[model samples]
Target: MGITDFFSDVWDTFAHPSPDAEAPKGGSSTETPAAGTPEESSEEAEVNKQDAVKSDESQQEQGHIPSDDAEEEEEEEEETVDPKDKLEADCQESKACAPAKHHYDECAERVMGQIENDGKAKEDCVEEFFHLAHCATQCAAKPLFSQLK
Candidate 1:
């Protein structure tokens, strides 16, 4: 699984305590950690309750959910140091570029920083610049998406 998934599994494990597999007893505490003192048990319970509250609140917040862009970037970065991840990500149009509300970051920067007469980086920036324009045009209903894929 992914990093978030792995972390989520760990969090689930710690947060939800279930009855022990072999414990069908009537007297022993099967759900809570057994070895802790009374004070520690109370403290742990309190902490868990607080964590639950925090997790629920975060889930309800606006526009904070994980995005494919972030996950892909993390995966690609882990796998390689090539700038092509950046280039490929910069030019994508559909769901790959969805996480960005309006503009892909690098393309935005390149377009905004397009210096005329000084054509040093102009050749390099051409691909992203056109792709950004085409993507925006598609979003505006003129439809340039098919031209890329």
Candidate 2:
């Protein structure tokens, strides 16, 4: 049908190979023969086939490729946590959101106070979340964390 197919067909006809003609040494088409006598020698292509088959089999058994699903599950489990853990779990979730959630919450509270209450207050209660987040994260790391209080 194509140039390669036509050439391969003609080559096959001339070689007069039987239907069961064995594949070359490594099962590949390209190999250079080492040394050949006029009557008793195979082409170089066959030796290359042996090398290829050996390499392919080695790769299959050794498994050089890392597992994608396992890595992803490990990362997902990083974010996954228990709801009953409450404060500890919240700390993990806060980290997932970023450390600035408290700072932003404080800013929002100040804005709300400015809108709802007097424009000038002696002191506004600012809820600093970063400070709390840091303290909580540290506390969770301790063995006797409650003693730290």
Candidate 3:
């Protein structure tokens, strides 16, 4: 599938969750059955559970299962690392990023200060913020550009 198709499918799944995925909250339903019986509800619950198992099996068959060890390692690493530290590490890894680091830092601080002190909405600063981000991204890709020349 093309990238657009793949993203469309992902968007559809996120926008509309499957009915069997989650139970109705507070036992409320728009359509009440005439019987209103306990046995029927129990049977429906059993069917939902079976459906969930089948869904999981299908995902596994399609090679969608995640590695438990990788997940655990990621959780452990997240607990030990701060977000700012991670961003700094990412910047340090790129030779082009080093020169633009000061500019990016200044832009970030200004944007944050405006949002906090001036009560400006993040959306209001998107244009300026994205410009700074684009500059940094360009700087970070300089090495690759030089190699092509």
Candidate 4:
């Protein structure tokens, strides 16, 4: 997906969680049917119970039995890494692009300084900023890409 789409998806995921994710807050999965409505047949409830048992057995057979809380905890752990930290770590690992990183950082500093001290608008530097950023990123990826050849 394009960067805009990707970021939009991330924003949506945070802003609007799925119904399944909100179910736990109600304290029970089985909800009582409204008055005058036919209740689920005994056979259907038994089948559902059996299915749940089978699912738990299969999960145990594979290794560990999964629970909603455990799954949520795993998801939380996976998301614990901050994006800025990941970017810094990646830059550190791309040692061959040290000069490019330095140049990119210097350019950023100069541009930001001009905007702050000289009353220049950030719109005036978007193109130059992105060009330097692209150059730096490509330079950083060059060595890694060459290894795949």
**Scored by Cα lDDT, where does model 4 land?**
0.67
1 or 2, greater by TM-score: 2
Model 3: lDDT of residue 11: 98
RMSD, one per candidate, in order: 23.2, 20.7, 15.0, 15.5
Q: Candidate 2 lDDT (Cα, whole model)?
A: 0.61
What's the distance in Å from true for residue 54, model 1? 87
Higher-ranked by TM-score: 3 or 4: 4
- What's the lDDT for all of these models? 0.60, 0.61, 0.66, 0.67
**Rank ordering of all candidates by lDDT, starting from the highest:** 4, 3, 2, 1
Which pairs clash (backbone N, Cα, C closer than 3 Å) in model 1? none
Superposed model 2: Cα runs more than 4 Å off = 1-44, 57-87, 91-104, 109-129, 143-149
Instruction: Give lDDT tens digits, candidate 1, residues 111-131.
Output: 556754354445355555565
Over the stretch 1-149, how does candidate 3's per-residue lDDT look in tens digits? 99999999999999997989987679556575556565456678999899999999999898788879868887877454444444445545556554455555666687778889878845354555455556555554655455446
Q: Could you say which candidate leads in TM-score?
A: 4
Cα shift from native, residue 1, model 3 (Å): 44
**Any idea what lDDT model 3 has?**
0.66
What's each prediction's TM-score?
0.18, 0.28, 0.27, 0.30
Model 4 C-alpha lDDT per residue in residues 22-99, reported as the tens digit of each score:
555545345666656668778878999999999989888997877799898988785444444444447554665565
Candidate 3 — which pairs collide? none
List the candidate 4 regions with Cα displacement exceeding 4 Å.
Answer: 1-38, 67-123, 134-149
Distance (Å) between predicted and true CA of 53, model 3?
A: 0.8
